[model samples]
Target chain A: MRHPSYLLACLYLLSLSACTSVTIDEYQRAEASLASGDRIVLLGRRHSPDYETEPDLINCVGKVISANQSGISVIPEKQFVDELYPWFEPRMAPMRPERLEYLMKQPQVREKIEDLKLRYVIWIDGSTQQTGSAGSVGCAVGPGGGGCFGFGTWDDKSDYEAEVWDYQKQDLVAKVSADAKGTSYMPALVVPIPLLARVQSNACKGLGAQLREIFVPDSSANAGA
Target chain B: MKKQLSRSLLMLSSLILAACSSQLTVKGQFPSPLTTAMPLHGAAYYSPELISHSYAEDDEDRVKWNIQTGAAQQEFFDSLLPALFQQWAGHSPDPEGEAFKLPGVDIIVKPTLSDFQYSLPRETRSKIFEVWIKYNMQLYQNDGQLLADWFITAYGKTPSGFMQSDEAAMNEAIIVALRDLGANLTVNFSRVPELQDWMGKRDSSVQQQSADRGGVQNETP
Candidate 1:
């Protein structure tokens, strides 16, 4: 018979390897495609007092979108924010298409946008949170040795929405939302084994893929403008 | 064996104690604002107190934090002023001086730190370290008449990640707050009512001077 410790290890490892579930929902207004030299920028929403959409997630989506040979170019969030400075700051950033229109009226701003060849601005808003947690892990150190023992588990949920704005057109063209959920486990024998779920990463991939579909449809027949 | 054990225990206790206190210097670089400078010569004065600002907080849990951000604040304004005005000059800090009389200086600006506050993840029951900074900006005419006095507030927060040190998180928060401050100042400089009135007068004076010169030149021609 297998020892209980071995069984626990096997069981926990199996559970930790469980996959995360991600769902993507998209709403497109007609169709849109990127032309040569057209670039896109992904910015995180920070106006919310309680939470901030993490920059890492934005970078992840940007990378995923450009990963495929779709000729989709993405501007780094930091570079874009820096180039635009004060205008895209949390307080002054336009949260709506109408506000963006007003901002584009400024000659300086309009000129800079044109120079950047920026076609789309994707505003990402959302955060990953530990929805629920149970169990506990305790650690103790003594003269002889130190070790941690216990079982802990927590659930994480990531919900994000990306709003695509056609900068030249000064309007919202598409909206893509991603939701991902997973459970993480930590089972400690002599040392704690943390099995973390890629909850936010999964959400990012889903959002990125759906955004790609908007510009580069799955098939040429599916392409629309 | 017993002696070795005692040594180990003492070392462990010392390590735990060391983790309770955090001290860090906030450091960051500010990007030059990408806007057309106003057609005015400006001077900024950074007081000694504002350039040496620091905050310390101690709690019953023996958690001690000391954050130094004065240097960063000085750098932020130093980089921003030059880019925000057509002509910019920084003079020696003088707390008692009422007015500045420098050649071609149209406006004088003084920024002071009013308040600073922070919350740790444990206190807020969240995995985020947050900071808030309040500043009071005073704009003056070359002759010391106060043109505008207003408050600018900025906030920053970073979520705690596994294996991330408190110092790193707090530093990130401060950087974010500083960037926010720059953004607010740049975007809203003319939005202040008093400053708007001053700009209106300044613009009209320039227009009157141009018209007078034009009339003279036209008559001579």
Candidate 2:
């Protein structure tokens, strides 16, 4: 013969303890990994840009050319102007036109091209459609195991993608792809916010590792390149 | 009497056991509503370089955009305004319908360029986009009286590296702006009790007027 009050108290405590927690340590690790190098450049595309893979290919090649022991220099093939500042007059007034023109022609701007260096570049392409479900249900299991009931469930999904390009010889060296998915309850006790960050970090990590493998070979010739 | 007391205790125990065995669960349902609002009506105004500090005279000669931080503040706001309007509108009582009646709020957002300096390993140099945007909002009443005036600012940085497409960089800027705006708005709204009350009342009145008209009010003005 067991006491029912004791069992009820135990159940309440157990349910309360089930609350989910988020770990900032995971985010810190991801941030630390990204901050480790200075030469690498991360570029993202809005949707997938359709071009003869040349620009993409060239960017990858640029990465390989820019690769150094310090880190790889990744550059997007296209010059991204700030749409927010379309008209160059006021926003760029402080920047001397001649200076910008000169900088573009600067040896450094053309570093990898002139130096003939090898580097790694990643281009994120395409978005993903994700789906997920979550819920809670209250039920009663009798001595005879007859009474059972269902409570609730939830589902959600978001779309995004990353296309990674590794440049080694002014040619596309390597390409990698990653996707993110998320779902949670109404108030999203555990999933949405924290999970979204995790998804992004994981995707970036995957893309980075994949690009590293493609560009960095174990052979002596390519070991440092 | 003893037997009766024993039976009562047995019943009490049984009731407790039964209650404990059954679980009570509550489920909350929330539609994944689009959190963005229609773009706010505003423009990014650029001014000539307030101060020039670069050593390169050629750098000073570049035809600067209205605002000289690497990215354009106006373009960023254009893409971002609609979404922000939609988000702010969404949080309101009549998100879909009453937003338009409030008339478009006029916001002048300007970005101040600060400290765009970067150094390479052996002293190679690059530029940084250390920019801050100041948002001046004037909320107008139907009668043209300024209902609320607010000033909010946000900061973001673009390190020296491969410059992505203008659109991509702009999108990133917008995202940063939106995040900052959300936080600023949340804090502002929470702290200003009178504004919140006024907004609530105005929305309710708008809803009532629509109901009296026997039709829904169109959100677009």
lDDT of 2 by residue, A1-225 (tens): 376986675455444411222211111111112233334344444312121112233344345434444244553443321211221112221122233343234343345332423233344443322244555544455677643244333332222232332232233333344443434222222221122223333343344444544434332245435
iRMSD for each candidate structure, in the order shown: 1.5, 18.3
lDDT of 1 by residue, A85-155 (tens): 87898877998976878878777788888888999999999999989999999999999999999999999
Candidate 1 regions with alpha-carbon error over 4 angstroms: A1-16, A140-147, A219-225, B1-17, B58-62, B92-100, B202-221
lDDT of 2 by residue, B1-221 (tens): 99999999999998875553312111111111112232334333233341221222134333222223333333333444344343332111121224334345433333333323222112223222333455554444433344456676654333333455332333344343433443454234334454456667867998998787765345435
Which residue segments of model 2 deviate by more than 4 Å? A1-225, B1-34, B38-74, B84-128, B162-196, B206-221
lDDT of 1 by residue, B90-182 (tens): 763342375545556887888999999988889888888888999999987777677788899999888887788989999988988888888
Best by lDDT: 1
Error of 2 at B186 (Å): 11
Top-TM-score candidate index: 1
Worst 10 residues of 1 chain B by lDDT: B92-101
TM of each candidate vs. truth: 0.86, 0.27
